[model samples]
Target: MAMPAAEIEALIRAALPDAEVEITDLAGDGDHYAARVVSESFRGKSLVQRHKLVYEALGGRMGGELHALQLKTEVPN
Candidate 1:
């Protein structure tokens, strides 16, 4: 199964309303993606925590509807 990039962005934004999310189709396949997310909510969080937030936003879609993701997280300057 494959998930749409816009749906991924929407899921993340639903969790982090202030997040700036960019989703890329790395292999030109909907199942593989790279995402860069920046949010003020990540300021005090660690790298693992930030990723957890994004993953959580996906609602368990990883390894299922979404096959793979290369993720990067950042806090706003």
Candidate 2:
């Protein structure tokens, strides 16, 4: 099954309560998506680490129920 944008956002928010999450369905398929997450918690974290955090929020759905996610992570200014 494909993951919903709301589910994606909810997972991200659950991990980063202060994160500003924007999820887009890139291919009009529930499996493909793009997400931009901005959070103060990302401060001091490396790009790889930031991505890891987001992946962790997904709780291992990256390649199973969810696929092809173009993710962007940034710290709030």
Candidate 1 segments exceeding 4 Å error: none
lDDT of candidate 1 at residue 50, scale 0 to 100: 95
10 residues in a row with least lDDT, candidate 2: 68-77
- What's the TM-score of every candidate structure? 0.98, 0.97
Report every candidate's CA lDDT. Answer: 0.96, 0.95
Candidate 1 local lDDT, 1-77, one digit each (tens) = 88999999999999999999999999987999999999999999999999999999999999999999999999988
Flag regions of model 2 displaced more than 4 Å: none
Error of 1 at 77 (Å): 0.9
